[model samples]
Target chain A: MTEQGTTSTALRESITAGLRQAVKRRFGAAADIDAVEFTSLGGSNRTVLFDLVDGTARRRLVFRQETIIPANSPFLDPARQFRVLSLLYPEGLPLPEPIFEFDDEDSLARAYVVAFVEGETVPRRLLDAPRYERARQRFCAQAGEFLGRLHALDPAPAAFLAEVPDSIDPLATTMARIDRWGGVHPALELAARWLERHRPTSTRRCLLHGDFRTGNMLLDEEGMRAVLDWECAHLGAPAEDLGWLCLRSFRFGHVDRPVGGFGPREPFYAAYASASGHPVDPEEVRWWEIFGFIRWAHYNVMQAYGHQTGARRSAAFAACGRNIALIEYELLMTLAGHYH
Target chain B: MTQDAPSIDELLVTVREFVQEITPQLDGRDRYHAQCAVYLLDIVRRELGADGTDATAEQAMLARYLGDGAAGAAGLAALAAEIRSGRLDARSDELLADLTRQVVGKVRITRPDQLHPMHRESRPAE
Candidate 1:
């Protein structure tokens, strides 16, 4: 993690300050905002849980606001993110309840408000190391099931299509993004090019949890409470989720394990297939896997620059920039018929 | 060294070292590319461990499949371009399979087991 000072308390004060203004603006005069606690900080924004706890008042509620600009800055679009998520998931998927969101940049620079979801997202406990091992498979299965539910969502074209920009092919947009970073490593040129050639197209489109992985989902002792981070959410083929979950990079260290080092590909695919009633498509899986590798390499390049500029510095980010080479090698092998 | 050779992990270490030293002095995006070089090393290393093969065997497999001439076919980039162009399909499936086995052995590192053991997942299982 970047050594950005945890001015989180101070930031919490700032958010409380902001929320007090919001409450006064909306409720005018008698807004009894009780408390705000700084709960989480991540690569994108500062999150503070604002509690309007008037226990007897039927409106006991909490919301999240993106306050601080964490290192590389988060890709979340507070407005589009909440709107599309609400449309696609519609309370079916485990996700945040968006009471209100603002994209007017001026509101808080890079700010958003979401319902405070109380859960632990430190997946290592749920995957590898103990104390949570008994809950591992079930937890992993729940994460998969949530994503399965996500992939199973039909945004009904009109609402979903309206949210994403009119000018971009979701898959192509993703490929273009990967390509934008293609200039990074010569080692990856071949893989990047290979990914370009093999990019998959899925007409059976659905709302894709573009960044679905262990850390992206929020979990608790019971299981996944919510799948957070809709920053990269998009409309695409379901296989993208499959490929992303299985990508080796997400495995962290247990390279032997797929699905973010949580479990095997079959069970994940089985869970998704069962949810969607669509059997897994390995070709599509390969296509999406290639895309996943492409995405990984691209992001590594992006983060490498982040490390260099000293915007963010971490073993993983540094390791991430270095990780693209491995992604490249995988790409070349894939192109050379490695997985064929 | 045994016939298995330096191992992918060892090779990766070399690449990582290269990344550390070579990353500087390059300006603009090339600096980013350097990061990828480092990452590729890790990927190769992982695959080497996963596949239990060395560069020599991989090279030999490629050359044999290409009928003693494949490695020189304009580097990996050109080879990839050729593959994309479908020009390389001129080679027989046996030769193709040999080249494929080499590549497959490496890339399949991410998979948990030998479902097909030779081919990419054509479609998900029943």
Candidate 2:
């Protein structure tokens, strides 16, 4: 076998053995694992799905391990992500049930397991499939309701989220990341000036699913099943999540339907207002939507830099280097009121 | 010296076609990477096919803002610095127009499909 193949084999074996120990510790010695499969859905983590059989009961669970975290990554650490799940899962939110977190004894570093939620998370499939037409109709309200419920949750427990740079000052945080990534983006600099000058008034800071958007959500034909990918969760303006959900990038070619390419924004805004008792401000969301483009561009730059600097090597990331121009064009258009 | 018959653009098109044909046979990460390869190849093809007019126009536009001494990447960096330092805030309207043109030039190569209708209509006839 090649050197990389050999390394992967060793890693797989280690994960299997570690999982067996973890399962036995949680579900007794009779518990056994079967059908371990790695999933490529996660961008910065290793996701492995396995079925645990204890007597007649078989439960499919996901084991996610943090693989490559850049030094300036905005994602929450594995431990903090698990903590967020633990705190919010009991709130009756549509989230994966946290099974157990790995400790030193489990021999799995920075990994956690949660019960697998069944649904489709692919944006294109959800947006284009005829079977999802009804689901798309209901998606906006459901997303708004979820965000309202999520933002209503007490921020005291997730107080640790405040330490996130974005939670402090998102514009400064974005600018810092841009500077760190070599910062020659004149368009982004223009965006920074606009965002700085037109800062939104202080609103109630709440727990935000920082990466809330189309692909981050799992939905069936009925509606949303679970909100996934809480790595970007942080305490911030409630509208940040709403704006992120409406980002053109997340619309997946269905840009006409601003709400995750599902439907109009009014249903979402109305649902959010009804659920949270806070009136939806279109202007505030617009401000955030504009900021969203810049943030999205920053993320693309991050990926491209990672590829060029050999921190990670992937053709997809290499494409992001050029994709930045597309994003900048969109940003300029949005700023000029020529495009949403 | 003259180049071969199968030039860079031709080679890119051929490779992109091959990758697109083989994409269905691959699955998961390989399939995703193949799709990205197709996109990158298309970008290279468009870039290679472009004339030098846009580049020259962009440099002249930047020079208008940053003076003749500033040009190319250095000019862009200087413009960004000026924006960040708030020196260009008064000239934001003109800067925005120049930046829009600069970014549109790039999008013309990377992804013309993403351009606004107005911008698309504004593109010079082939």
Candidate 3:
């Protein structure tokens, strides 16, 4: 059967009842579950928007729950995400505040709730909407500065973050992940070999926001309000984030601007260098961009396999198999020095 | 010799019409899935149209690249393993050219739109 959003009628009712009891127990007062809307983000977690009412006090919260859906990253545990948020939110970084985490027997799922950051997370709207015109103009430089600060954080103190494995050799790890899937596209295979051979040496390693791109960021009338989706966070070369941001898939046809379709790469790199006190290497970033496309292609192929094998079935997942060709074409162009 | 009553093109045209009729009726997640369904059908139709030529050309290219009768995915996997283990040079002009040809062929079938404008204007020689 077609997978609807995480909440069916029965599940919704049960969740609301359970949530009411939990909230009451925590707050020492009765709180009504006004409404619950389950929004599927096509990840391992189910995004739930729920309203809690206590007299005039009403709070709209985002409750994330682990689904049966296979996670894209090995490091997507919500407990780890809560730990990351605990550090970032206090530093005045624009992120959802981690409210509470629940894993008790009475709780419906392994879930955590956070105060929702209001904005449009859709890539197209963030890119094209006139309301976001001002936001788009300032986003690239802001993103660069933000990332520089993130990468400069003292990772020594964050022992919990270390639980997510450090990818000492990202190229080898990425290649292994692709090989494990056991599907061969000759272009992908060749690209992998090229990347492996030409792997750059990175001097300093820091926390990399594994999926830093336009779509993962939240935009509003003002500008980029908050960075969302921290599932892929890990300790690696900071170039990982920069390269991922410039990937063709993340750019959404704004090929000219390598930084989130906002503006030129020069300004972004300039800001990052100024803030981080580290020199930005375009070559290193380009290498990661190529790696991003390869990783994304492998992901699409795996998604298609998931559909075919009946591990998970969806029309969208089935269509992902065809998307590998487009990604492969981009990979060839990038390798041939045709695509930027 | 007589063909089947519903030709492949005829079946695709009917499917297109059905999709156009049904898609507007769907909303929210269902509408999204309907769009994916339409796209999948279109890809299938394109694949069916070019199946013979692409398969034959790909097999021949694969055999030539591997320098043996080994062709298709299994052959490519073995070649990839060799490259991974440092036996084969991935940076060689021969391997790059062959891989480009293979990739270009795939783009023609699955995403002709992504091909460079110059290449798209002039379809690759058979």
Question: TM-scores of the models, in the given order?
Answer: 0.65, 0.96, 0.94
Q: Candidate 3, residues A255-330: lDDT per residue as tens digits?
A: 7877877788988998899879998999999988889888788778778878888888888888898888888888
lDDT of each: 0.58, 0.88, 0.77
| DockQ, every prediction | 0.06, 0.68, 0.64
* Per-model C-alpha RMSD: 9.8, 2.1, 2.1
- Name the docking class for model 3: medium
Output the number of the DockQ-best candidate. 2
- Where does model 1 exceed 4 Å of error? A1-12, A24-35, A55-76, A103-110, A139-144, A157-175, A178-187, A196-202, A307-319, A330-340, B1-126
Q: What would the per-residue lDDT of candidate 1 be over residues A320-339, giving only the tens digit for each residue? A: 65445456555555555544
* Candidate 1: TM-score, chain B only: 0.36
DockQ order, best first, reads 2, 3, 1
Interface RMSD of 2: 2.1
Local distance difference test, candidate 1:
0.58
Clashing pairs in 2: none
Best by lDDT: 2
